[model samples]
Target: MSKHPKPNALIWLILSVVVIALDQWSKAWVLRDLPEYTAIPVIEGFWNWYRTYNTGAAFSFLSDAGGWQIWFFTGLAVGISGLLTFWLSRAARGDWRQALPYSLVVGGALGNVIDRLMHGHVIDFIQWHWRDHYWPAFNLADSAIVAGAVGIALFGLFDGKRSKKA
Candidate 1:
């Protein structure tokens, strides 16, 4: 058998690029038109486009840390994306379960990194809520990251079962 992985292994990179493009484009639209912190409801009491910024990690962790979190999160995203890229390169080409999740994560990380570098914060606009309860604002990059993480977890569960049957 040939030593090289199948071309499909690299196909996931295209999806990653698309995610990055969509994320940046959507953020650009929001930045240009939306007034910061103003909510425009798409679904009454449920969803809204609320432009905001996060200077720290998920859920604004360390957001109030006196501005140092920018570089910290930037560096963290860079490091994580690099590691995921390396992992992707080494993963089996035919294994979509592995390759796709890693690609999603890498795309999401780089997407947010672009925002951090250019705006000094991650632009967030999508908001979901119920009555007084609200989830933190997030964007396309955050969605992809969460989905990818969940996919990886589900893969682990199924893969473990398959391995035991072998």
Candidate 2:
């Protein structure tokens, strides 16, 4: 009897490529058009196209640790992306839940990685704020990473509950 091989979610990697493209393109635009350390108002009191740079992990963690944090973060992102790619290979073709989040993480991680390698810092442009408080500046890659992390956490929680009920 002839048997065909089962499909895998590796195809979802296309999303990763798309994410990387968009993230890079946006950063390029910011570099070319946006002024550094200045807020170009987008919502009068809420948002702006504020260009900035980060050399460390989320929320500028370790951003002031001299210079070694750059390579450390780059290696960390690459390692995590590699691990996610491996997981995607093992995921079932129908498992969008697993593939999607993993793909997002890879895309986001690699996108920022490109920045770190080329510019020695990740370029950030989008900014949100109120009258007195402001969220840290971030980029599309950061958004994707946050979304993916949320998906992984939420879906994993649901999965755990499902298995428990079963």
Q: Highest lDDT: give the candidate number.
A: 2
Error of 2 at 136 (Å): 0.2
Q: In model 2, which runs have C-alpha deviations exceeding 4 angstroms? A: none
* Tens digits of per-residue lDDT for model 1, 13-97: 8878999999999999998999999999999999999999999889999999998899988898889888877777777778999
Model 1 residue runs over 4 Å out of place are 1-8
The best candidate by TM-score is: 2
C-alpha lDDT of all candidate models, in order = 0.90, 0.94
Residue 133 in model 2: lDDT: 95
Q: What's each prediction's clash count?
A: 0, 0
Name the lDDT value of residue 64 in candidate 1: 91
- For every model shown, what is its TM-score relative to the native structure? 0.93, 0.97
